[model samples]
Target: MKIFNVFPETIFSIGPVHITDTVITTWLVMIAIITISYFATRKLSVKPSFFQEIIEAVFEAIEVTIKDILPVEPWLVIPVLGTLWILIGFSNLAGLIPGLKTPTADLNTTFAFALISFSMTHVIGIATQGLKGYLMHYKEPTWLLLPFHLIAEVTRTIALAVRLFGNMLSGDMITIILLGIVGLLVPVPFSLLHIIIALIQAYIFGVLTLVFIAGGIRTKS
Candidate 1:
């Protein structure tokens, strides 16, 4: 009856070492991304095939979204945003597999992903507008407001990580509970709903990343 038992965990570890089901899943997710992307981009075609077409459509959509959000340099944002969308989108959908759990279902995994985005956001900001300019922006309107701006950034990153982790973990929990009570057939509707939730979470994460990056790149008036 304990659903948690199915998740593997290492008994003990040496210095700087920790292991868990989530770690295994994270590695799998990275490998999956590398494998898919390598093959997807391995051969460029003048006349695209089905896989290439799908990849192109996804990139095109990301490009358009970036253009809408950051008018000045859509090209600059495309690679980052596009890669995030694809990687997160694939990781989210990975839960649908019978034996695999989505990495997003684990708080550690989601937080790590969110932290990377958060760091990149600031790094991009500093790169776009030098350290002095970037730091000065927080004092805009009034120096007293700097603390509030800093708090907002931290709160936003925590919110992003928790939102994704909560949604995916809840979906997985719900599916397991329903399956226990009524077996697989009854869980079909819930699974379908989970699929929708997964896609939405990925889209939301991607859009938020785009917005943060765009804001960072914008100049103060």
Candidate 2:
């Protein structure tokens, strides 16, 4: 087994863009999600099949969770939240396959996800509340807190990236070590635990994104 601590090995390069195994695995995960999604929604009926029912149940659960957090205009961000959840879910699970590492185990992938969430939070905030209002929010309670608030914005973004990366990397490492030490079948419980952890990480990441967006739009009373 190839043991990579953090950085993924580069498989090849397309001109300036170096494609790593993580990138290939990530693309495969994306393809899997897209293909599954396409077929799942291809046929529609008033009465649903087993497959359709499963899909609908998943969607309903996600929608309910988003609504519980955002409450208002939940539908507006469903696409983003749903996509993030699926992508992260698949990326985390990809590590289970031999010769394929989980993308989330790499800092690059987690940082990219965090950066996107950070950008969207500000964009949504500015769009919902004017630029002046968004800026003024930092000065709330006292003008002295503005610097701390500004620092927080940057720190939280970094924290998001580091938190996911650390959790995913550590989980993958533990699983790999256990599998190596113990025979495969003996480590089945750890494998299952890893799967559960992957789902929880994805859920946490998605919920946090929703929270950031909601915070952006919430008006100071």
Candidate 3:
């Protein structure tokens, strides 16, 4: 019944540093991604299996989405999109496992992802356009709009974190509560719905990253 207390107590600490359940879940997610990718790409086959086909389809879909968003250098977006898709997709699905918590269910994990996306957006922007150009993006069209642009950037990143964290956490919490209330039978439908939501969240996260990256790459007029 103590849901929020699910995180394990810190086993060790250095100064003010502390580790918890959220950190462990994040490592597990990363490991899952590494294992999947290693096996998926390890054996090069002339004829692909069902799993390979599905994996290929996912990569292809990501490629298409990136191209649609960036047009010119879709490849640049692949590493970010691919990693996010795998990590978030698996984390969301982790709810199906008993006694396991989805990493995204933790605000810290979700915020970390959002921060990475935000940092990458600006880094890519600065790399593509010089530092002067990146800074000038906020000062564009009219000087009066500068504050709005700055606020928009911060708002979007917060929105991204909250949207992902809120959805996954709520879904998992609802499923858990339903299981406790009505036992097993009634939770089935909700579980299926959770699956769909998991996939949708992954897609939304990827698309938003693409959008932010694309926006960053745009030249100011």
Give me the candidate number with maximum TM-score: 2
Model 2 per-residue lDDT tens digits across residues 1-221:
24575788899999999999888989999999999999989996889999999999999989999889873577777887788888999898888787788899999999899988888787767766779877767677789997887788888888888888898899888876876887576557887888899899989888888888777566544
Report model 2's TM-score to 2 decimal places.
0.93
Q: Residue 210 of model 2: what lDDT?
A: 82
How much is 194 displaced in model 3, in angstroms?
0.9
Please provide, for model 1 over 62-167, each residue's C-alpha lDDT reduced to its tens digit, 9 standing for 90 to 100: 7887778763567656777677777677777777776666777777777877887898777767776778877777777789997898898899899999999888
lDDT of 2 at 130: 76
lDDT of 3 by residue, 1-221 (tens): 12545344564677898977667667777787888889999885779988889889998988887887873476666887677777888888876766566878888878888998898888877777778877877776778998898999999999999999999888878877887888877777887898999999988998898788777567554
Prediction-by-prediction clash tally: 0, 0, 0
Please give the TM-score that candidate 1 achieves against the real structure.
0.88
Q: Candidate 3, which segments miss by more than 4 Å at Cα?
A: 1-16
Model 3: which ten-residue window has the lowest total lDDT? 1-10
Report how far residue 141 has shifted in candidate 1, in Å. Answer: 1.9
- What residue pairs are clashing in model 2? none
Each model's lDDT = 0.76, 0.83, 0.79
Q: Return the candidate ranking by TM-score, descending.
A: 2, 3, 1
Best by lDDT: 2
Off by over 4 Å in 2: 1-5
Q: Estimate each model's TM-score.
A: 0.88, 0.93, 0.90
